[model samples]
Target: MKQRFLITILVIAMFSGCKKFLNVDPLDSLSGNNFWKTRQDAETYTREVYRLFREGVAIRTGMILVGDLRCAPVAYGAYPPRGDFNLLSSNSIRTLVNTPRIQGDINTYWQVHGAWDVISDWTPIYKVVQAANVLYEKAPDVAEADQSMSAELIRKYQAEAVFMRCLSYFFMIRLFGDVPYYTNAYNDVPLPRTKDVEVAKACIAELEAHRNDLPWTYEDPANRAVRAMRGSAIALEMDLNMWLAGIDEANKKMYYEETDRLGDELTASNAYKLLPMENIAQVFAGRSEEGLFEVPQNVNYGDVLGNIRRTFTGAVLHYPYIQLNQNSTKSELTYTDGYLKKLYPEEANDLRKKYWFDNNIYNEDGTMQCFKFFNLALGENNTTASLSNYFIIFRYAGALLLQAEALANLEEGSQKAEALLNQVRTRAGADLYSAGTDKNLPDAIFYERSKELMGEGHYYYDLVRSRKIYNPDYCYRPISYGNFVQGAWLWPISEKALVNNPHMTLNNYWR
Candidate 1:
């Protein structure tokens, strides 16, 4: 595991000791000594952390794997029975989607991929967290040191950093359950796991306290909708609120209320909205109008590509890799007939059925691939025309669905919930559910979200947070939904994570 940064205090002390005792001007003062003394310094350090967050194994790839593949909600049939097994391997030629070995139990996770380099490398996330923590602690002092820097500007910088830490922790808990909480950059000792509920409470409080510091949109030159802003923080709060509702029974009401408030505030602003149904598929191409925060991946840097595209692209299309290549084992891309029907029911005519998934599901040749993030290689340019698809972290549709779920749970805003659900459904060219006819409005809201956010990586978490993935009989199960709720759907903390910090233990259920 690589350390993201040395302790800021230790570095300053070490450098200060190196200065001349006679007050002679030094020829080699470290640049880091002046780092937190200016606004530019704060901004520059932020870019590094954001870059690290993008490349981190857990963030870059784990989101799609846990949110979509691990407990797949659809039976994506494939030729040669492409395996949907979850492991952390770079062997993309025989990917988990293409060749699922089907080891679903905690005891058997090691048998699938012993090293577990990809998904299990949770350390990378800690790097980003540490960076944010350092920034959060130093920004205020930096502003105080510089006479020209305003306290307001410093607070905004601090708020964004806090949002980053909170965002990373939110996903950490979502993926690994309990995680060791850190605030300073130098906490290298092994720490015990903190209860997720407490962590969530702390994070949400921090976000709410500083929400006013950020703006609704950040289109500044250095960050044009690329970084965390007010809307991004609000969206995160909505997700955390919903997840807390499922985990913390004592505070369930509070969670719902905050969820409703944040959703309402974000919706009322009208800063972002769902695009027309026709452009839904193209939403993943990068800075679309509806995006709250999307991580850009430039093709020139040779990004790892999106898991949605890599896992869902069928062997038929010669995208990314040529059709002739032997690495053509893409089974986890197609959905079973029953799952397709459930996704877009008979009465509902979701345009997403065509825009997101392959329209011709009946084609036996197995050409039905998800078109959202497909990296089409123009045969003439030899990969020159192919571009990286942006990872959509937060969007308007997701925010609206979160609000609709909260309203449904309250059972007081049936009309508002229906309107919220309809905003997404109506855009998708889907038939709207009448408030009078829908008895289980809560389930309907959750289901509509499942369809709208299917391949974009929200379904599995949605099921777990709403306590819907616990039952084997749950209707959302794909054909290979094994060990669905034996462990609350949280992955075991890697052996490496434990070794790095021996005080930490495996997730409660896995232990």
Candidate 2:
């Protein structure tokens, strides 16, 4: 991550306008043309692009929806007394919407408007993509003091950009279903929305083509550390392909083949390894062995403050540590011990239960609040200040599970699937694998995913995708008999987008 600092300094040097370039005014602002003259300039721009990519991946919306932390209550017209974590609440109503739920008006689902508007609005992403495209197109023409090194750097930058673009599109497709797939930034007019399967395939192809260009290991200045080699890319590719396979038949076959190949590559590379259950919290507590890709958040880096995890998971009684001041409601009902017990009743002895939550509070007489995210001592200013915790986007455990699921789906009664499932389950201190025909492979995977990745924003996707396979009726349900029909699966398209893009079509579930 510290290598990124070199790029940051480069951005400041080129864009800072301190240098008198080509007899230009000394104090005049530098344009993109004036900046891309040297290898250093391109390097800095590429770093900034990477920084943005990291930010996009760690967005709270993706985390909240995927992690299964928040759910809509019965009053809002969802089932299980709460909506699944993956499904965003409709924007048609405001009162029921809360943190970890869709913010602003409910109509935003159909219209494409909200705090998330900046992200879904599609400006910043294109900017990053455009910068990457420019670097790739101009790298050959630029004269560098070290020509070979400069060209190699340019290639690396281009690969990173392509990886980021594919990643951005993957998230967009998951959230919006159909989105305009932009290959080149210059083609500005919004392209027609492609089917989700098509988009996933394109994303996979781009990752595969550019995988070799990216460096497997990056040197860290802080501890002279090295992390995220080629294995990381292969693991990510496997994950993306597995997701694509679950969506459709053609994609299923393509993704399965890719996953198998990548899985073998990952196993052969031996660069990444899973963390022990005892070490999982510490792994998350700081930087540990498990994170495949993560967004580094340093308190010194001004933009990286705030207890987003604590704020989302903590109850009001927990107060300041949880950022309770941000919300109006302060009821204890929100934190249901019974609900949690029900979720993990069978594994009470598991150490993860203790690591996953803190049953104590700081206030003189306060009840226990969720302290899974509290890291007071790691911040810069206050002991209770937000710590610089990197959000883990992908982990080796996820890879293991993905491999298991792929095997189960492809080959009937494969022992590999059960063995893989047990590996993760045993680590979590759950029941051992038995030699029996379990028809609920998806459910087993979902349960393991829920336990292993709680509060990480994967629950919603698991729930919705599982519904598509196991129970279709539960996939779409009426929000209320007359008020609105919040389907069993599929989030409503933001209404704000609909208002802006006439060509945008609402999902059948929403209409």
TM-score of every prediction relative to native = 0.80, 0.72
lDDT per residue for candidate 1 within 1-511, as digits (tens), equals 0122433332334323222211112222123364677776676677766776776632345455446544543443343433333332111211332233345553333223322335555666776776777777677766666776688877888888888888888878887877878666445356788899888888989999987898877665336457777888899898888889988978888888888899889988877777887765456665666787777776565554333234323222333343323445343344443555666665667677666555564443345555555444333254433335566778888888888888877758778888888888888888887967777788788778766766566777776776666544543342223544445366655566554444667755444
Which residues of candidate 2, in runs, are more than 4 Å off? 1-32, 55-120, 139-151, 221-229, 250-254, 285-287, 302-320, 323-339, 346-349, 359-368, 376-386, 436-441, 468-511
Residues 1-511, candidate 2: write the lDDT tens digits.
5645654443334323322111112222223344556666656566676676655445423333332432321111111122222223333322222224345544323222113323334434444454455455555444544354465666666676777667666666656677767665234242456787788778777778877887654555221111233555676687677767666755576667667677767666665566776666555554455556655655575533343422233322234443333432231214332334544664445666665554532221224444444564454235234544456566777777777777767765357777878888777776665657556675566567766765555655654443332333322222332332234234445444454354566555544
TM-score of 2: 0.72
- Alpha-carbon error at 383 in model 2, in Å? 4.7
Error of 2 at 20 (Å): 35
The most accurate candidate by TM-score is 1
Candidate-wise lDDT, in order: 0.63, 0.51
